[model samples]
Target chain A: MSQAACIVGIGETDFCRKPGSGMSQLALQLRAATAAIQDAGLTPRVIDGIMPFPNLGRAEQFAANLGCENLRFAATIHTGGAAPVASLQAAATAVNAGMATHVLLPAGWNGYSGARVRQTVSQDVASIPGGAIARDYYLPFGFTAPPQWYSVMARRHMYEFGTTPEQLGTIAVTMRKHAQLNPKAVMHGRSMTLDDYLASPMLADPYRFFDCCLETDGAAAVVVTSAERARDLAAKPIQIMSGACGQPYPADEITNRKDFFRTGLSIAAPEAFGKAGIGPSDVDFAMIYDCFTFELLQQLEEAGFCKRGEGGHFVEGGRIELGGELPVNTHGGLLSEAHVLGMSHITEAVRQLRGEAEGRQVEGAEIGVVTGWGDFGDGSIAILRR
Target chain B: MSEYTKPLPELEGHTKDFYGFCKQGELHFQRCSACGTWRHVPRELCAECGSWDWEWARSSGRGEVYTWTVVGRALHPAFQQSCPYAPTVIELEEGVRLLSEVLDVAPEALEIGMPVEVVFEAVTDEITLPKFKRVAAS
Candidate 1:
């Protein structure tokens, strides 16, 4: 069997409320892509493969603008936030198949500065056009925005497992603390108390103002290559031991899923761990996606960090904090850091495994996991090791 | 009462039958003729057997609340006056769930497994939405 591919380089733009540059979306992508190429100690000419998260930006446009001399392979995966890990899986597959040597994956969004800002409040936010899932079923009943759809599961988790708002508050509080150590975080230096969380106005019931991820304008990129090539790169190679994306039955339509509290990660976790030849117990730390604090709670259970429905209590007393066991989102995930569609989580995992995560580093961390949740709990997991 | 301001379902393809039945004030779902499995959101293939064969079965409109959330924020201008409406999932006796607006009840009063019955409201001259009302305990 071929050896696992490695993340040779990772780069991110200044994460902020608005990217002050007048650059188009493609320009932001090229900046991150060029930075990643330079970080890998390779010129853009060596990049022969391009894999982008579906529909964020055009792969051909990136290859052309970034000056990739040999764009031998290009593909994209669409699962919303799940696209990050899915792109990693595609890179591994392409590299292992000898389809390309160096692969670039770039993600960028101007969510705050672009017209997309209005999308967050629109009932038609993020739904597939001409699709029954949103147009026919959800939008008709005001199940429109991402927060609204996720709140159904949050309420169900509360009803089924008696998960308290305070437990979920721990996740938000912990992420903010992590963000304090990350200068690039949008919410950096903005401290939050559990009481602050409780007092924040309700955006959707069960989700206070702090419960939602920030609308950010930023970009991040990653470079994947053969493990052998990674050894020759500037940064320590973070091996992609395993990457997988999946969903449980009735995946897209949240209301129809068999178990509302359970995410697709329930199915994806074992698949990733099994492929990595490791289990959840082997993970030293992790970067579970936190688009919403409750998502982190549910993902903790789905990723086998705790028993089903016990995630609320698992987060209590700072278990996921920086100094605690299984320190997650060490760079303050999408919740506190920036929502680059979970690509930031992947870069944080690379940083933690490489021992480059300056202040928020998990002590002596060797093995770690990154997870993505999107589109009504469709999940993706990637297990990485130094 | 003023007509509901939220967007109404656009009838097309598989959803035509669903709204057609709702226009007549009857809740309908597809039960696979081959596998006898019930499905929602009105699709063609059987969820269990992969059979394209199915029939429109009328729902008794009697079910219990499986789970729900009160959308405190209005996602659209139409819902501005209707903030704090509870959009719920009602698990009908047929064992398939449907998303509907819950009416005649305060969000605080809604609970899991609470009994509910369907009520059709004409939002427009052409569209009649099927919502749910709390069924008082006997």
Candidate 2:
């Protein structure tokens, strides 16, 4: 049998709100990819597989730019923000099946410097997920942004579960607090109290400005190989225990879902935890996707860390803070960290497993979980162990 | 009419019929002939079954507020003038949800399970949107 897949190298470009000259999307991706290849103690020519983020670029283009020749396996995960974590499954499967020796996964975009979702007027329906639905049903009603689309679910959650704005504020405050320890975080040293969170301008009802993630122009990359080959690599290997991706019913549209509270994580978390022979309690730390404050809280409940509707209380009393029960988003998160489409969450997971997280490191952390929340409730989860 | 600066639905393919129905001052959804499952934002096949047999059935134009959000900032350029509007999801009596604006209702007065009924507005000669209003207690 082939050895289990392991992550040997991880690299990321500087997370920033704005990019200087020459920081195109592809440029950011190439910078991160080169760093990861070198960190793995290998050259570009040795990499035999590639997985690129959907709609950003193609695998062949990335392979050619990185000087990676003789590529065997190539695939792109189209699960939106969930693409990065979902790509791990494809990379691991390729390596263990002898289809490839080394697989490189890269995800990034010029969210700030280029086409921003909030600012850009999308004319091509083919480019966006559920474009027809959005154009026909949503945009006509002035619901044109992510915060507007997701706020309905958050509002329903508040109505059914009695979730509060303060509960959601706790997540924003905690993530900003965690960002304070990492200098790479875009919001590092920008202190925010719970009062500050409440004082932030409301973008969408039930979602204050602080509830949203940063629109960053950056990239992050990871190198995966079999466990046997990882023994010879320069960096310590963090085993890819298991990972999976899932979509909620009628994945593209959220308004018609039979159960409003159920999300893609509600389906994926069980399968991922089952495959790993572990549960939420076994996780030493987690990198739950923090695209929004309510989203992070919802993922926590859906991922089985807490029961449904209990997320509002689960985050209170500093339980998710650095020293608390389960330190979440130790390298900040999409909320305070740059939003490289959740790829930074995976890099942070690797850093935690390698005991290189510096001041924000969870001491003696041997196992961790990373999750991704994408367009319209799509979710992916990966469990890693040192 | 102030040029109706907001976005208008792209009436094409499966979506053309939906907008056509609205333009006629009526609301309808595709209901599967095989399983009787009503669906919206029109598609070809039934979600519950694999049947392609469906029809655009007229609705009673009544529903309850399932969920809502009050937009304090308009993300789109055309909607900048309409700041602080409420976009709502109305669960129609036919068991389908439609996203539309709730007219003449204060944002604070919107509540889950509040009864509402559909109303029409002709934004342009080509499109008539189906908006909603709170049903007075009777």
Index of the highest-TM-score prediction: 2
lDDT: worst 10-residue window of model 1 chain B = B1-10
Clashes of each: 0, 0
Query: In angstroms, how far off is A291's CA in candidate 1?
Result: 0.8
A116-165, model 2: which lDDT tens digit per residue?
Answer: 77776334456555777887788889888888888899999898889999
lDDT of each: 0.83, 0.88
Q: How many clashing pairs in candidate 2?
A: 0
- Please give the DockQ score of every candidate, comma-separated: 0.70, 0.81
Q: Model 2, B42-138: lDDT tens per residue?
A: 8889979999999999999999999988889888887888889988999999999999988978987888888999999989999899999889754
lDDT of model 2 at position A20? 39
TM-score of chain A taken by itself, candidate 1 = 0.96
